[model samples]
Target: MMKEISLEGKTALVTGGASGIGYAIASEMIDAGAEVVIVGRRADKLQEATEKLGDRCRWYQFDVTHVDEYDQLLNQVDEKSPVDILVNNAGINIKKDFFDFRAEEFDRIVETQAKAPFMLSQAVAERMKERKSGNIIFISSLATILGMHEIQAYTVCKSGVKGLARSLARDLGPYGIRVNSLNPGFVYTDMLEKTNLKTPERLKEIEEKTPLKGFTQAKDLGMAAVFLASDAARFITGIDLVVDGGISSSFLI
Candidate 1:
């Protein structure tokens, strides 16, 4: 097997990286020898993730919605070393009936998932465009393409992420900066476990719906993130890689 993926000297900044999928991505980059900085709003979780990822990983306490600080944050963290990879994985989901969904919930999800990533990409993109090399990846959800009973806000926001990736890839292609989106369907994270999804019936239902007959693991997502951020994906840009088990609800319906 030829080794085409490597993050030897790259630096990755992951938002909402204190736990769940974000932390997994940070850990993957660190394991691959990339300097990693995990950002989150909570200081305690940030500290915990930093400790878990060890030396190559550091923690930054900053709210992704705090639009005021994002402009100067990338430069502050990577003043000497340019950030080679950016993973905008921070997002919030409100599980509520569509009619029950308030305007505020919609705004929050859009702020964290769509706007913050857009602005932060712009922030790091300037440096990447200047250096003529970089990778930007967004972790989108399957709901972006389907109708869910709840989580309407999250779905809409992720839909924007996919759209952003498409436009950004075209806009940044000239500068040698790659922009892409990774759509992971029902990845089992610590947060998901908290949903009390341990029932055998629920598991079977999920497995049956998915062609692969199993849920996506967070570590799998981590590896995917690292690969997209690596030189192996150099020719790949503006593509959305779906990590689902091939149910293709979006296609069938």
Candidate 2:
């Protein structure tokens, strides 16, 4: 028999779930038999995604950076059903040289990536704590491991998110809540396609450098999120689940 990874009877709230990695993870959670709530700032995108995801999914439009709104959002969600799985996937990045980053840019990056996840996780964790069980999955990035040129703000926020996961895992483990970070490496999404990695030649560079000989698909990260949220990972916490096709581990000869 296949090892069970079912999330039957569970409810998941995925931030930034209208597109890209967030949508992928939400899809995976639905396939694993969980009810999913997709949270995004774009109402149209959220509506479209919810329709495509079918009956098991719903949408909530909210800007995750607004920390004060978290309680109200959580309360609304809790009324329907308490969130059993919280995916802290909402984030933003501005690629600029360290010297060029303005104070506003720095704050924007930190607010969206670091502060947003921290705030949402804390809000969800409170409900999870009351229930005495929940899963908190954070979406971090390879930037924390590899030194990519520019993107200092992205690097700082991603690193801070990973640290938040570790600290939460330690503090919340005793209460039966599991907190972990999923660090994705070079996943080719629309956002990524718009970046410097757009061209075929640039894509080929990533394939040549990655130990697995290719960049990760969004679904790969999705499936990883499913596993992390499932009971199969019951004993796992405070770990960085790197789903980067071994890119971060390999070095040039």
Candidate 3:
């Protein structure tokens, strides 16, 4: 018999949970019986998501890039419920030629996608260590594996997230904390629509290239996350789970 997948007693903290992939993860976690705390920089988005997620959902409006404020945010959430899962899904992208990319722009992406997750994990892991259990998920990208153009900063930081997960998994394993990263491929989201899927040709190209001949939806990643966070994936750690519909394995003939 297959082990039942459930997060009945877990409380998850998902950054960037206001919309897109993050919001999908929050919704999926709630469906799997986990209370979700959605965090983002916008109050309006948080409020809207909270209402849609029902009573098991809560909202915290804070920028994850603000490293110093993580403790305060954690304290506030911990006061109500200790965080059992942390999804580092908040990210930003700047599309430009590598030659034209500025150092500051690279730093901004790194700070948000890479540094913020590291810092937040450190803070949450401390609490989990006390209890000897936790789960951490990093939202990486297939860009780290495939050669993608005009998103060097995003690719670099996302790659770094995988490295962070491996190292953290090793360090936290003894404490029963599992760290893993999910690499999504060509997911259809508001961000993707604005950046990568701007043109019909580009969209068609992506579909044709993917072995599954379609784009991965936000909920696909959400379900993958629920699997990783649940006891079903209890022994999984230090790995990058690719939920990209086989695109990573396909090649142009």
Clashing pairs in 3: none
The sequence of per-residue lDDT tens digits that candidate 1 reaches over residues 102-152 is: 888788878987899988888889888889999999888777766655677
Off by over 4 Å in 2: 1-3
Candidate with best lDDT: 3
What TM-score would you give candidate 2 relative to the actual structure? 0.96
Residue range 1-253, candidate 3, lDDT tens digits: 1345888889999999999999999999999999999999999999998999999999989998988998899999999899999999998998889999999998998899889999999999999999999999999898888888788889889989999999999999999999999888888898887767788988888888888888998999999999999899999999999998898887761
Worst 10 residues of 2 by lDDT: 190-199
**Candidate 1, lDDT over the whole model:** 0.83
Model 3 residue runs over 4 Å out of place are 1-3
Error of 2 at 70 (Å): 1.2
Candidate 1 segments whose C-alpha is farther than 4 A from its true place: 1-3, 190-200, 249-253
Q: Report residue 252 deviation for candidate 1 (angstroms).
A: 9.4
Distance from true position, residue 31, model 1, in Å?
1.6
Candidate numbers sorted by lDDT from highest down: 3, 2, 1
Question: 1-253 in candidate 2: lDDT tens per residue?
Answer: 1355998889999999999999999999999999999998899999999999999999888999888888889888878888999999987778767898899989988889888898888888988998899999998888888888778888888898899899999999988999999999888887777654757888888899888888788899999999999988989999999998888988841
Backbone clash numbers for all candidates listed: 0, 0, 0
